[model samples]
Target chain A: MKAWSIEKPGSREVLKQIDVDKPEPQTGELLIKVKAAGINRTDTLTRQNAALKKPYPILGVEVSGVVDSNQSTDSKLNAGTRVCGLVNHGGYGEYVVMRADRAMILPDELSFKEGAAIPEVFLTAYQTIYWLGELKNEEKILIHAAGSGVGTAAIQLAKQLSQATIFATAGKPEKQEMARKLGASVTINYKEESFDERINDVTKGTGVDVILDFVGASYWPMNLASCAADARWVLIGMLGGSEVERVSLSELMRKRIALKGTLLTPRSDEYKASLSREFMQIAMPLFKEKKLQPIIHTVLPFEKLPEAHRIMENDENIGKIIIKMNQ
Target chain B: MKAWSIEKPGSREVLKQIDVDKPEPQTGELLIKVKAAGINRTDTLTRQNAALKKPYPILGVEVSGVVDSNQSTDSKLNAGTRVCGLVNHGGYGEYVVMRADRAMILPDELSFKEGAAIPEVFLTAYQTIYWLGELKNEEKILIHAAGSGVGTAAIQLAKQLSQATIFATAGKPEKQEMARKLGASVTINYKEESFDERINDVTKGTGVDVILDFVGASYWPMNLASCAADARWVLIGMLGGSEVERVSLSELMRKRIALKGTLLTPRSDEYKASLSREFMQIAMPLFKEKKLQPIIHTVLPFEKLPEAHRIMENDENIGKIIIKMNQ
Candidate 1:
């Protein structure tokens, strides 16, 4: 089995392709033959040994694969069944073991590349927007990083499921246009104008009811200023920066805001399993119906994994960048 | 009618007794002849025109009284019916009007002072601990300002309702003892030792599941250090200060903590009515059984309302400070 592994933590140059023995399925696990895998910002972080606490070896967190061996109680998931799931790690390998409960059956209508793109971003978007953010029907939502994988997924889901009026902020014009096409009622190029002021103006002073904040410190002041009373702010990523100077708790209190911080990779297996079940039950049909499409920026051959990382590092991709693992 | 009102925003000297016309009940409202009133920190803030948005004439928020007039649709609340409720304002007067839906029938076992004490602090505590915090049975909770009115009320409610393991932080020895007596499993004299270190040591580094924070800026670091993964921190007050010099969003994400800020005063009439209804259903029976007790530090006459404000300002009292209106 060929897999990408890091001997030591550093730049993308540290990622090494090597032959390794295939992993065995443990109890309540399935041995998956990787067909396609998704690249995420967390992969870069894991390569640097920043967040992923596991011993360095494989990098990917989400994959579309075929069940090679099943050791779980669920009879529906048989060997050779097509599936995609969120893994603890090792998705960049030929053979990766995933918890049986976390695996979602990939619909026949979607390709492996599209299936690979759905788990990480879609589940994260689901978790942040619905579970943590508690977005209600006809509410207003402000989604930052509107071009990112999770951002695109969130816009579509909020549009299809909640009927929420979407406000999006993206740096690139292409990203802004994509966000608008997906669902955003108002799109702001954050580089050109302040999103808070624009959103405030559009809303006629009352800010959005929910905010999906990916840019943390850089957007904190605006996020604070852009919340309606009893707004929910879910922090899924901090791409711009991490630390904010002079944070005021009084403003949060006055608006009665709920700020929740979350990361999909760090969540427990049980949580992932539960989230997968709920998401598949609700969102899989939408994918099958082509109502919710997986937005892919590019799909690269497995050998071009380094290029995929480079593209993401440079923030050139509008949505998910997938790696066809078997190619 | 004689009432305590503030002409200008200032110290306790500004709280002056004046003659005012008795208020009449509007639609869905009841005019009550006040028997007793509860003093809170918000009352002091109202004296200084801090949080309350209403005009600066009255100085109280919760009272227990007999119904003088009813323009409300509720058939049970007739004239002279004993009732207690949260008011938008005007609880310090000889007569006050409150939304009928917000009023609760006083249990025969409780006095007017006891009823007065139940509305504001108990409701706020309930909202913070159970509603926002989502504390489950046997989970550990850390309650700050353990001797303050809401703190004492929360200690009692969490004890009787969830059977939670309570850790409390207080400045004075008497407050600590009162917290213990109410139901706190452990009490920390916050003035003497670092609460975060003690809590971390006790939980074996996992920290508490939920925290009720009243001291804001001063407790930010300690509160961050004292949370378990997926912990809920509800900020209901800012007794210490409101600004933090440096805040790390990454740290909050790593812990997956939910920080919510709330003030019961500014919530809408419908929200107050709903909260009052739910609280009465769940907690009133326990009060009738004497399983829940309102801890009162002193009962001062209406003329001595200024002294009550001074005592609260100086942080001298233990539980709720009640003003007996018709003494």
Candidate 2:
């Protein structure tokens, strides 16, 4: 099996393609012949940071593939069934092993590239918006990094599930337009305008009911200032920086704001299995009905894994970047 | 009518005895012949901050008294009924006005001083532990300021409602002993030892499930460090300082901790009414059974209101400080 492995820490040059022995499925697990793998910012950071505790040298977290083998006798998935699922590691390989319960049957309506992009982004967006944020119908929401994978997914999910008013922020003009097209009632090019002021204007000073933030510290003040009373701010990533400058505890208390930090990769297998079941039950139908679709910015060959990382690092993609594995 | 008014902000000396026109009960409101008023940190902060937008000069927030008048035609409360309730202001007076719906009929087993201490502390504690923190039976919780009004109330509530293991932090030895007497399985004198280390030692590095924190910035790092995976840290006050020194976004996300900022005074009357109803249903029976009781440090005459504030500022009280009115 050929896989992209982090040869060293700190640069895209560290990613190396090497041949390795194919991994076998463990109990209640399935070996999937990878068709496509999703590229995420987590991969880039994990490769660059020497201090991160990597479980494996391989860098991918999500993949779409065909079931090659099932270890458990009671496994529902049969060989050759198309599936997409999250993996702790080794997704950026010719064959990857994943827990059977976490695997979802990829709908015939979706392509392998689309399936590869769905699990991480959609599940993260769903968990944050519905489970953590508890976004209600008719409430307003602000999605930061609106051009990114989870941001686009959140917009689509919010639109399809509820009558929420969506506000979005992206850096580039084309990305902003894409967000607007996706279902954003207001899209601000954060590079050109203050999102806080824009939110205040659009909401008539009441502010948005929920904010999905990836840019930490740098946007902390703006995020706090742009929240309505009893607003929920869900933090999924720290793209900009980590240490917040100054937080007014009084303001947070007065507004009754809740700040929740979450990540999917570090979650337990049981939690992931439950989330997969929920996503399949609630969101899969929407996908089958074409009410929700994956927003793929670009799909590169598996050999060009470095290129995918470069594109993500430069923030050039409007949505998910996928790497198609060579058959 | 006699009342204590903030003559001008900046010190306890500014709290002055003044004569004011007796307030008539507005529609859906009640006029009470005040019996006792609870002194809280909010009162002290309001008195010190000249910039605070006070609704009225009178500072008290919770009161217990005989219902002198009811303005609503459909009001369940009648004249001469003993009631304890939350007030936006004017509680530190011979006569006070409160929303009829926010008033709870005083339990026969409780005294007026005890009733006055109950509404603010118990409601705040219940909202934090049960509602915000979502504490479960057999889970562990760390309560800071364990000798304060809310802390004492929380200890009692957690003991009666759930089999939660309570860990408390107080500044003084006597306070620590008082916390243990109430229900805390372990009590730490925060001034004498590192709470974070103690928590780690006690939980064997697993950490506590919920943290009820009021000391903001000073305890922020410790709070984050001491929380177990998926823990909820509920913040109700910022007695230590408002601005946090530094926050690690990675630490917060890795732990999946939720930091919630809350205040009871700023909530809408309808919201408080709902909370009141919930408290009555879940906690009132415990009071009747004597399973829960308000811990009053001292009950002084109304003229000694300034002395009560001094005691609160000096952190001299073991539990709630109450000021009683001589009708």
Candidate 3:
């Protein structure tokens, strides 16, 4: 099988197309023929990490494909069944092994490219907003990086499922407009205006009940200033920066804030399986009914995998970027 | 009626004994004839707060006494029924008002001083460890300020209810010994040794599952270092300064830590009532069985309330400091 593997960790320059043995299905696993793979920031981080050895695992972490073989006889994920879900690794290849329970059946109405975009962002948004953030109906949520994959998914999920009032922040006009179109009641150009001031004005100084913070250190003070009493803050990404200086713990105590930091990739297999199952049960029907849609920015061919990584690294894409594998 | 009220927000000199009118109970409320009152750090903080106007609210927030009057006809509480509870204010007086639903029936085995020690510290500990920290059986927990009121209460509750592995940190030898006696598996003298290093050595780098932090800024880095993945850290106090410099959000994300800051005093009446009912139901039996007991350091006469505040301000007391009102 043809796969994109890093010879040594550095940049896109280290990426090389090489021949690798096809993955085999273990017990309770399914061998899938990759149709489409989604690109994420985690891939770039893995590429830049010096600790990863040569022949580094394939880049992507999510895929949409057809089950070529299934070891579990009782499961519905038999040969030729279309599915899409997160993987431990090795998604940037012709074939990959997936745990049977983690796979979400791809609906007939959606294409493989769309399916590839659904798992990582939607599942992350679901886990962060509902499971961790505990967002409720009639509550308010402030989602930063509104143009990013998880940001877009969170806005949609918070809007459709919880009927929450959504406040979105983006650096660009196009991104802010897109966020507004996707059920955001208010959108702010973070580069042009101070979001905390805007939040204070809009909320009448009470602030939002929940915040999905992707920009960490750079936004800490603003996030702190924009939280209501007993607010839930879930940090999913630190895109702006990571080092925060002179933080006052008393402010958090006074407001009674709950701040949680998480990454979906490092979770255990059992946790992923459970989250995937719950997400599929609740979201699949919406996907089939066209009430929820996966936002895709571009679909690059298999040979243009490096280009896809570059697009994501530069933050030029509005939503998910996909790498389509030729049959 | 004799009452102790702060003339202004200052030191012990500001606290003066003055005659005030007896409090009256409203609907679903009880008029408590105060027998004992507990002193807390919140009382000292209120004394130091410069924003408070002249003739500030009475010092105490928790008391144990007999019900002088009960307005609720259907409730079990009647005149002369022994009770202890948290009050909104005016606890440092001959008479105070308590919500009928928030009062706990005093067991015959405990004295008025012991009952007074139970409300503030025990409720804070239970809410922090169980409600917020979510400590489970077999999980490891690190409790800071091991000799303090809430610290002692938390150690006993975690040990008795969840059977959790308890790690306690305190500045004084006497405090450490008291923590050990209360069922802490490991007690570290924080003044003598670095707690994070000691914790690293003991847990073999896995760190604790939950942490009860009262030191705030001074312990932020150490708390971050000592947390295991998915650890729940509840911050209830900031005794050792509140400003922290140079915090890394990436570290929190890597560990997936959940940090919550709360103060029980600011909670709504409904929330307090619910928590009080739940705590009474689960813990009252243990109190009756002699399995749970409140720790008291000193009991000063009501007229010497200023001395009690001084003792707490100096951090000289081990457990709760009580003010006993003569019959």
TM per model?
0.96, 0.90, 0.97
Listed in order, the DockQ scores are 0.89, 0.69, 0.89
Residue A96's lDDT in candidate 3: 94
Chain B TM-score of every predicted model: 0.96, 0.95, 0.97
Return the candidate ranking by TM-score, descending.
3, 1, 2
Q: What's the CA error at residue A273 for candidate 1, in Å?
A: 1.0
Residue-by-residue lDDT tens digits, candidate 2, B117-195: 8999999999999889999998999999998889999988887798789999998888888888889999999888999
lDDT of 3 by residue, A118-154 (tens): 9999999999999899999989999999999999999
How many clashes (backbone N, Cα, C below 3 Å) per candidate?
0, 0, 0
For each candidate in the order shown, give its overall lDDT on alpha carbons.
0.92, 0.90, 0.92
- Which ranges of candidate 1 are over 4 A from the true structure? A50-55, B50-56
Model with the higher lDDT, candidate 1 or 2 = 1
Write down the TM-score of model 3's second chain: 0.97
- Backbone clashes in model 3, listed as residue pairs: none
Best by TM-score, which number? 3
Residue B221, candidate 3: how far off, in angstroms? 1.8
Model 1 agreement with the true structure over A65-125: per-residue lDDT tens digits = 8999999989889898999989988999998999999999999999999999999999999
lDDT of 3: 0.92
